[model samples]
Target: MTKTFVIDGKTIPFEDGQTIMQAASAAGVYITHLCHNPQFTPHGSCKLCTVNVNGRNCSACTFPASEGQNVTNISKELNEDREKITQMLFVEGNHFCPSCEKTGNCQLQAVAYHLNMTDNHFPHFFENREVDASHPDVMIDHNRCIFCTLCVRASEQVDGKNVFAISGRGIDKRLVVNSPSGLLKDSALDVSDCAAHICPTGAILIKRTGYSVPIGQRIYDHAHIDAVALASEGEAHDH
Candidate 1:
């Protein structure tokens, strides 16, 4: 018999080595998260997947799923907290969705819409960050990054290129290029690199491809994020 755990009243089975996220995704359950790319190792930095597991708050992305454990995934308080977290992410960055090319295709935006984030609850940081258009086919707009490290892990794991890394401490945290000149043009990144397109936001983008599909006909334009996230990742795990 398969070992199982209860998440939001639904029983989800899991193998020994699978994390709570892996099991949930395989079972068609969506746990809101930004830092989790099943293609790469789980990085629980976002804390968006925080669930009430047996009266304790733990990151579902890193927390292992065990037998008979009760997990509270979707609740009133959980959804409210997720909305606040999404709002904080917006205020921390310079996200102008109307002007952004990744407006409709962005995961962050989709998550915000999914959680019903109607307005910016907090004050904007408005931090002046870098927009490196030095690379001919790629660009880095630091203002939109939420520090999810998707690009950083994608480069190292998939492309086998250590082209990106997150540097600095808390509050001062920022993405850093691997080149000596500290620019995308100087780095060993190409248009085909996994890191070039793995950003969950508009932080990293391919040049000249902006608005290719138009705003209204984009990824998140029609579908909700719960459906989108289900179809996006997590296929090669212990399914």
Candidate 2:
């Protein structure tokens, strides 16, 4: 039987046992979320896509959608909170988009522009982290990570290699590769590995194509994230 849930002031039909995020995506309702990759199990870690479920803040990516459930996706308050979260992410990491490789197509960057964030308000932590280039094919740049956990989830769930694991707790937490030796190449990941394909940033890049796309033609080259967001909004309207 098909069930219906109200999303963004409209009734959306979805089946039982489907997540709100999944239903929204299928219904073309774009919810701002990270760490809830369709390719991997929903972790709901980033909490970027939190929505109002029956008037309470809840993570939409993992929340179950049911008949008659009232889901509020877009709102001034929720949008503000999401912007604050994105701002935290911006200040927490060294996401200097001009210098970073994943400038435009980066989901975090896209969402930031969607939120109209011009500058990071908070002070930077500037934690000294090093990029591990031991892997011949890919590099692990923890400095650029927002602790989204997509990489970890991708490695463990999608790739079935269980190479990446989170260590420490709270702000100290960082990704660590599992193996007798502490190296990504030493782990089950190879150059053409599936785990590397799901990374959203330059953190896990294919060595061969590192510089293949000229700077001008790269994904984020011509557009600031706002243009992409506008284009996406236009596409949604057209559809």
Candidate 3:
């Protein structure tokens, strides 16, 4: 007998040690998320993948799937909360989509479109973060960072280089370079490192490759994030 759980009335099978997010993805069910790379350990910081498991809200990316468990992912209240979270992320960062090179390819931007976010509901923080152009092959635009820590984890776990870390606390939390000069150029990051390409926003970009793909022909411009994410799961895992 196969064990399964219910998500929005759809039964999803799960193997032992698999998370709710993993099971749903395997079943072709989309769960909105950020900071969740199948190649790395799940960090439930983003909260965009929050789902009601047995009537209790939990992060689908980190929550384990249990037999006969009930999960609610699609609901009016949940969608509204997700939209608010998405909006807050926009207001908290300097995400000027039109001017950003990662506009259409950005996961954050794609998720916002999927959620139908038309405006940033909160007042803008307009943080005066720095743009580090010290690296010859890459750039770090801190202003657009949502602090998802994808780069941090990728560098540490996959690349075996602790090049990035989070510093401060609460609203003061920010990404930091692991060098005495606090510069990416001093770190061990190469253009091919997973950390270099794992950023969900334009915070970390490969120099000279910006606008290589025309605006109208970008990834999300042609397909929804759900499909793109599902299709990229294998590639992401192999990275």
| Candidate 2 wrong stretches, greater than 4 Å | 215-239
Ten residues in sequence with the least summed lDDT for candidate 3: 230-239
The sequence of per-residue lDDT tens digits that candidate 1 reaches over residues 1-239 is 99999999999989999899999999999999989988889999988899999999999999999998899999999989898989999999999999898999999999998888899899999999989999999999999999999999999999999999999988999999999999999999999988998899999989999968987899899999888778765455544
| Candidate 1 residue runs with Cα over 4 Å from true position | 234-239
* Cα-based RMSD of candidate 3: 1.3
Residue range 62-94, candidate 3, lDDT tens digits: 999999999999898888899999999998989
CA-lDDT, candidates in order: 0.91, 0.76, 0.92
Residue pairs clashing in model 2 are none
User: How far out, in Å, is residue 123 in model 1?
Assistant: 0.9
